[model samples]
Target chain A: MSWTRKHLLGLQDLSRDEIQLILDTAEPCKEIFTRPIKKLPTLRGRVMVNLFYEPSTRTRTSFELAGKWMSVDVINISTNLSSVAKGESLKDTAKTIEALGADFVVIRHYAAGSAKLLAETVQVSVINAGDGAHEHPTQALLDLFTIRDKKGSIEGLHVAIVGDILHSRVARSNIWGLTKMGAKVTVIGPPTLIPQEIEQMGAEVSYDLDEVIPHVDVINMLRIQKERQVAGLFPSLREYSVLYGLNRRRLDQARDDVLVIHPGPTNLGVEITSEVAEDPRASIDEQVTNGVAVRMAVLYLLSGGKDIP
Target chain B: MSLLIKGGRVIDPAGGIDAPADILIEGGQIIGVGTDLPAAKEELPAQGLVVVPGFIDLHVHLREPGYEYKETIASGTRAAARGGFTSVVCMPNTNPPVDNKAVVEFILAEGARNGAVRVYPIGAITKGRRGEELTEMADLAAAGVVAFSDDGNTIMNAVVMRRALEYGKMLDLPLSVHCEDVNLAGQGLMNEGRTSTLLGLPGQTRAAENVIIARDVELARLTGGRVHFAHVSTKEGVELVRRAKKLGLRVSAEATPHHLTLTDELVATYDPNTKVSPPLRTREDVEALRAGLLDGTIDCVATDHAPHSRDDKEVEYSHAAWGMVGLETAWPVIYTHLVLTGCLSLIQAIDLFTRKPAELFNLPGGRIAAGQPADLVLFDPKKNQRVTEELLVGKSKNSPFIGQELQGWPVYTIVGGQARWVDEIGR
Candidate 1:
């Protein structure tokens, strides 16, 4: 199918076919990374802007690399060092970016629906990097790519997303993407950390990680913010690690072929242990590598580039 | 000047009248109500219309004495007049809140000077609404406050709330409480449910409101103080209030038109206008609220007519201010959604807006009989109008109902026998 959508706001609104098209396009994009030069002229002369309202090291850098590899001019505007620090509104900042002639705007804002707001205000194609706890479309896309790459197919795979499900944009987007692609997904976290009525989104809920581990083909662990302990969502780091952390003992109970994945900057001893992270079955590093390819697929499609090289 | 309101279905629930009648007004009072006895010096043609006692909104934020950029007493009262409300009790959450006698007098004076309709100020329960020390309730009541509240800030301290309720009982004024456990509702932007999960916005659980409602009802029973729950939005909250009434406690509750009609599913649009305190709940909650209104478990329909500046609502949903401008849209929305949908009869709905609210707060001007104040609204129930920016007379236009076509808009709002607002287009 020809690309028609101008923005990638969330996985919830995308049709199954649209998601498949994105994943299918990522196949060729992934091949370019193994080449010596790792560059493409398909999107040459296109301008993209990374407008991040929150501090980020990974998603922003991944988008930057995606734009650079595609020969697109990329500009980074961290809010702390820009007009936003002087109290400029999001609308004004988006308009300023549009007036500067950027063709694509990748936004990571601290407020939910900020990316949608920017898309409504500008004529440029917008990609949601992450918007509060709302959605991180690209992160979910890369995750889907990594899963498909490792397991050969996403259909019929039982994936368990464990940890801080209520506050994790990564978890929400993955649930939408995974469910639409015909995966049986289960979200496991403390009852307080799991959002209410999430089963309506086509996911099963569980509190015990070990019980769910034996039945799943993939385990996507979300980072637990230390502030959550202070806010009283959970008791303590030691207690959380004991209850939900993916350590060697829990890994032993999982399927032998089970792939453990994490959206990086993991709390080492909190959600996942050093042994499990370094397990050959763990695809954490490979997920980061797939992130750039998925973003490239997004950038190319949004810019109306078809006939993937 | 003596005036005659000619031939209309006058629904006066307070007087047990619902029939075609002509009202004769003289000296700012209804002198006669029956078949026309004689023509007067002035006449208003009200044929093919339904005339009722003007609406009484128990909760509104005039945003005066401070945040005038959002709404001044002048603009808010004008909007109330256009919405068919003749009397509105303004909440005390404005800057330099109405916690003292001086602030109460200032609001009353400002309302008298610039208001198009009567505006009654509600004094704060705490000084600055800090939920710390209790305000001098007796002094504020003496200064002409119709009630007491610390709306927009729930009294999180049960001890302080109980003390305030004690003082309220002594003063014989109901404390209108905005109930929500702050810690339980932390950083939540919308109702916690399927919609919030799908949208990925932080969800404010219904338990947050229910827990406080449960606490405050016990406190009301303990102190024998009259408690008025503002904008009760959850099913369990409605049930709690129902139980409170069954126990014969001096407790009352109101549901806003938005909460009674809209649901949390609308938040999918990510419109900041839909953001409200106690957020729009599920369809089941809306049904419960409608049931409460029918069974008289909920005392009245309040507008909770909060107004905010455009800048306050034109941003991200999480960053946007809570509340929508309700005064100008309350009647049309309720009329179209509730009355036309058969959830309520015309007279029953009018009673909810008029006599019920007046009786709860013990305010004047909710009846239409000889010697009663001539406050009335005339509207064609069959008429249709789309809510738009131009249709909103309030200074702020943060209404979620904008662009919605609604029937039964008020055409002429007569306050104290004078026409405060007239719809030239409808006429």
Candidate 2:
């Protein structure tokens, strides 16, 4: 299958075939990491810029590594190091990057629809690293790749996304991606943390995480911010950990083959306990490795590189 | 100089007159309104047009005394004239907001010097609209402010709001309020609902506006003062105002044309022009507002004609400023959406724009009769016009109606016996 999209803004509008093609391409992309020389000359002449308005570690590092592994030039610009601190608008910053001959812009902004704005402003391809609570397409693609690698196929699988679904771009992207691939997604979170009309997005909402733990094929836990507690989303972190935390006791109730995943910087003993984070069923580390592979697939496809090696 | 407006279907809702008539004007006042009126020195032929009282908008932001780049009284009033408005009560949200008698007098003087239409300033309810200390309401009223408001900033302090309402009762001036509890509206860029969830933009709940409306209605009942809601955009807000009116409280509300016509679903396009405070609500809320307007729960339709520059709007959805330019598009949009759709009769629509707002504020000239001000509009309901940036007389072209085709444009907007804005193409 051929890839034709100019920008990877979100997973919501992506067709099942387009998503499968990315997953299918990422299979070969993952093999390069195991080789003695982990580099490809396919995108040698391409230049990719990472423009992050919000602070992020894994998504930025993953995209940078993916670009470098493909022999592409990658330049990183965080908010403080760029003119964004001087109050330059997203449009101006994007146009400046385009003027400097950047072929791709991977943006992660705090405001929703910011990536779409950058995509509209510049001629280059855009990959949404994360835009507010909107979507993280590559992260979802990598999650899909990791889940498919373990489970063989995505169809009819029960996937539960727990934690703050209201403000989690990762959960939004996964819900769109997993559901499109025929997975039944049940979003587990506090009622305040689950946004209004989320059922319309093809996910069933459940407040009680314990009831959903045993019935799911995969559980993806989103990072819960301590500030959310300060904002009174929940009463206390101790209570939150007691209620939603995936400890050994709670993990024992799940199916033997059930996989636990997290988009990390995980607050240990908060969303998940130390024992469960290191459990054999946890695929968090593999998800990170697959993140690079999936990103490589996206960068290759968006740069018009055909014939996966 | 005297002028004669000949052969028009006059619709004076205030006077209950809807008939073909000729109106004679002398010295800026109507002298006669009947057939076979004596010919004057100057004559305007209105063959098949509908002649009605000049529109009065209760909520408009002229942006004078500061923020001239966005709009000035001169440009705003010209926009008002083009939209067939002869008088407008400007909000007090300027740079140095209209808090004192000096500012009020300054606005009145500027309006007299540069405005194409009558400009009535609304003094701030609080000093600098900070919602702390109440402004000198008596002095402001003596200085000729038509109303008082802390628009764009809700008076969050309930005690302060109560005191302001008490002063409003003593001063006999309605306090126009911009209803929003900022804490409840935290970081929200659009209405909280399915669309906001789908778009991933932070959602402002309808409770943010409704809770304050409920508060102000109780305060109005307690203080026995007139509290006018500015740009009520939710079904719950309409219901609150409707119930308040039924309880015989001195509470009134105005709905903007954008609120009545547009919905939150439009924000899915991520256009900043669609961003507004009390951010456009659901389709059900729009229907409720229309129903409210029809039933007199919503007293009148105000433009809430907020003007912003391209620099303020041409950015990310979260960073872009709220509000859209509504002055020049108000009449045609209301005409196209409400009048042509049979939701409201031509006369009912005109009454909302004319007599209702005038009577609510006790402003003069809402009807064409003997010894009345000759502020009038000649509108052609069938005339089609496309809204464009170049067509706008206002300095800023931040209107959402740009590029849409609408009908029923005002052919001529006459203020005080003189044609202030004439549609040359229509002529």
Candidate 3:
């Protein structure tokens, strides 16, 4: 029922039960994470690299800390400054990483199947950190861990993944983890940003966030829907917030126990209000804690808790 | 069951017949297609039905076995059903590929077991669709392969393609090359045009597609072999094919439904649905495709019905895959754009959807004839409506023509005398 070592990929279809297993596993790992001289032999002498082509400070740092706590050597490759920036193909970059004797690669490329591409090319294990908004398996697993630690189980959670879902690898990841964990999810956003087929993965599709917020146990807001403005996608950010954003008033309308979350570098006052993020009941910090633990489990499992070959 | 298709303008282009035909079907065969020869025991009475031959698509990517999330043989053949096609030549792009006899047999077995529509597996011209070396064509054709194509990718080496054509001539099978010179298509998101410039993304030029067509046609002449280009989009490609036919080169081309209606103007929208391979061309090129479709220079209108999951499609324009879910929209859009524009008659236009493609690819079952398998479609052309995701039947919904009002809609799709999908009462 628990994750031994499966790389997190797209959350397009992970059920609530499956997500709960990772979450439950993360709770004990969280205790292991918070202790002084936080290090474990579970993954000693194993190596991992966080190759992020896209900037995800919260995700990148959490995975790094997780690997470090697991006593695994972790290297952070900023895709912006690496050979990737120098026009190296993903396969070439993967081969280089593999050649470095790294056992696991946590990649965040800007192409949907970049992780799969890297995984296919490399002999080493590949954990999709976030691939071109394709999937962010670790993020979703951590989100599940947080919810399960706070609420005890994900099965009856009534989770809502709202905003910029079409562009957020995090949304895709969480969908796989949360749905498999047994939570009934409702994806809330403009029809344009929320793709048409998420419901097939067992989530309810909603255009009006106001209608679904009251019924949700957790409201996870993706980054405010990004726009180049000329792509004919989103019109106004101010208007997007008006229709779907979770604010202080909006939170009050929900069940008092309902949790609010932002994957972070929060768009404050856009996807959510400062007040809601700062709320004592908000299990947001716990998610960061769970993120490290979940990633440790991932690294340990992907590396098989062993020394280099 | 006996049937009398009562007040319908039956257009059999192959039979050189165009008039009201009260067709009769019995024992799974079209016993009477023209004016009534004998009274039938069971008369459904097709009152004003545009009964043409059951359609066959020359090109379709029924991604089965490996990439089933996109489309399976069962789902893809179902999509063919919705498109009013009774037979679909499944491209050789399956997981293990229909490149050899064993793969061909497996595909045929799966199609026979699950496909509502007749599925003819097209063997790969090369092993694993890598286009490095040609497959054993004589063996594949013996295994009942309809044709040969490295559909998803082109035969990059002209020498390899010319050899493929030469081998195909020996087997009498056409080497259907997906013509795209990687050099021209490199770093391209959509077509090289105002839209790509506006989007600030790399653009794939028509030269990417055109140069290959011209080179291949010349090669076809040199080799004295047949070459059929799959999904021709560029004007130069069509013009080359047109001239090659005139120059006594045994060459043919199939234009997809998207190329006829959608211009590269759509990629301007930056929606992934508008993003397609040989990326929808300029307005001038679209007009050329439409004109070619009418004049019969373009042999058949095929649906390069590529289905991608939501996650697969919901990305930046440059990063997203180049295809759209076109099975459901192909007929409606073709009806709205070509048929309504005086470009073709209802009879001639329906041929592109039905019999013409069958004749082009040498596939049987395009027409509902005596002793023929009962592959037919019952359509209601007057029902015009906008295409919404809600109405789509396929597993994925990534279409660009969601809001446009389309005139021609298939109400009841019947393949092999079996009703696969029937429209609701209100529809």
Candidate 4:
């Protein structure tokens, strides 16, 4: 299978075959980490720039390591140190990077649709690291890869995404990716954190996670930022923890084979308890590892890697 | 100056006249409106056109004396003339803010010097539109300000608003309001609903505008002040205004041509041109606004012709400035969507743009009979037109209707018996 799109902006517009093709290509990439010579010469001459307007450590580090492991050169540009501090516009910064011959530009911005704006301005391939609450295509791709690797199949699975769905770009991307792969997604969160008309996007919403736990095959817990709760969405953190927190007692209510996942920097006792975070059934570590493999496949395919067997 | 408009279908809603007639104008006042009228120095055969009273936009941002790079009294009124408007009541949210009698006098002087059509200034309801203290409403009225409004910023303090309304009744001027609660509308770039969620932008819920409208309608009832709600964009807002009108309260509301035709679905593209305050709502809201207009719940259709520079609008959706340049497109949009589609009769649509707003603001030029000003627009509804950037006479070309094909085109816009702006169809 071949990947033809010039950019990976979001999972909402991608077809099911295009998604499966990305997963299939990432399968061989996971094997490289086990070898002593972990580097590959697949994209040795390519240059990728990570342009992060918002602060992020895990996603940026994952992309940098993915590029180095494939022997591709990667440069990181945080807005704090760049000319963006001098009031340079996004269009000018993108043109400057493209003029320097970067093959791909991965951008994360505070404004939704900013990645799409950057892609239209430059000639190079673009990847959306995360744009506001918009989408995180690579993260969703990694989640899909991890889910499929563990379950051996993705079709007809019931996945419940819990926590702050309104401000979580991860939740939106997963909703698009998982639903496209024939998974029924139930976004479980407080009404304030769940944007109105989210059901129009083909997701069933439930406020009570306990009621939804028994019917799900996978539970992806999104990290709840303290600032989101400060907007008077809920009473307090302790109250939130008591209401939506996934503890050992609640974990036993699920099926024996049910998998728990969290997009990292988990608030220990806020969204999930310590016991459930390190539970044997949790796939947090696998998601991080698969994140790198999936990004390597994205860079390879976007740089014109023809086919994978 | 004497002028004759021949064989046109004249629709004067104020006079309840809709028939083919020849209007003879003498010294800027209509002398006759009958067939076989005496010949004048200038005569035009307007057989295929429909003549209506000169349109008046109750809301517009001229942006002069400060942000002239975005618009000026000259370019803004020229745009109004091209759109078949004879007068526009300019909003008071300028750089220095039109809070004092001096600013009102300054705007009147500039309008006389450079305006292509009549420009009426609306003084600020609060000092510098800060929403804390009241402006000198009596002194501003004596300075010839047509209305009072703190547009582009809502009067957040309810006590200040009540005092303004109570005092506004004595002056007999309409208190226009830009209804929005900043706390509830926090950081929202678009309307709150399915589209905003799908697009991942912050959403401003309908309650933000609705709650403010509900409060002001009750205040209008209490103070007995003539309250004019500017650019009402939500379904619940229309309902509140409708109920207030039924209760015989001195409350009126206006819906913009943009609000009546477009919905929040357009914001899915994240085009900052669609970014407006009281952000464009759902299709249900648009339908309700149209219904309100037809049933007399919405009294007028204002342009809300806000102008912004290309630099201000070419940025990211969240960073881009709010508003669109609307005067040049308001007529054709209403003509196509509201009039031609049978949602409202032609005469009813024309009255919203003409007599209703003129009477609300107490401005001149609403009628077109003997002893009335020769303010008129000859519109050809069969003309096929497209809105290109070049077709706009305004200083800014940030209109949402830039690429739309519309049905009606104003052939001749005459003010004070002079053909100020004439389209190709008139030739």
Summarize candidate 3's per-residue lDDT along A82-199 as a digit string, tens digits: 8878877666778888999998888877755666656656788888887655567887787777776677777778998998765666776677677676778888888766653456
Ordered from best to worst lDDT, the candidate numbers read 2, 1, 4, 3
Considering just the first chain, candidate 2 attains a TM-score of 0.99
| lDDT: the better of candidates 3 and 4 | 4
Q: Give the higher-TM-score candidate: 1 or 4.
A: 1
TM-score of each: 0.98, 0.98, 0.60, 0.97
Q: Give the alpha carbon lDDT tens digit for every residue of B1-427 in model 3.
A: 6655566766676666678777777666777777746877755555655667777788877788688898888888877777777788878877888878998898899999998688888889989888798888899999999888888688888888878887788788787778899877876667765554333345677899999998998999999987888999988888899999899888888898888887877764457778788788888998888777766678888888888887677654556676887777787777778788877787777777777777667877766567776677766778788889876677778888888888767766666556676667622
Native-vs-model 1 lDDT? 0.92
DockQ of each: 0.81, 0.83, 0.02, 0.81
Order of candidate numbers by TM-score, starting with the best: 2, 1, 4, 3
Candidate 2 chain B lDDT trough over 10 residues, lowest sum: B418-427
Which candidate's DockQ is highest? 2
* Candidate 2 total steric clashes: 0
Per residue, candidate 4 scores C-alpha lDDT tens digits across B1-427 of 7888998999999999999999999998889998889999988899889999999999999998799999999999999989999999999989788999888889999998888888999999999889999999999999999999999789888999999999988899999999999999899989988899999999998898989999999999889988999999988999999999989999889999889989899987778889988688889999999999989999999989999998898778999989998888899999998888899999899999999988888899888778888889888879878999998999999898888999888878888887878987454
**Candidate 1 residue lDDT tens string, B1-427:** 9999998889999889999999999999999999945899998889999999999999999999899999999999999999999999999988899989888888899998999999999999999999999988889999998888889899999999999988787779898999999989988899988999888898998999999999999999999999999999998999999999999999999999999999999999999999999899999999999999999999899999989998999998988999998998899888999999999998899999999999989999888999989999998898899889999999999999999999999999999998998999535
A237 Cα displacement, candidate 1 (Å) = 1.7
Model 4 chain B: lowest-lDDT 10 consecutive positions: B418-427
Residue A216's C-alpha lDDT in candidate 4?
A: 93
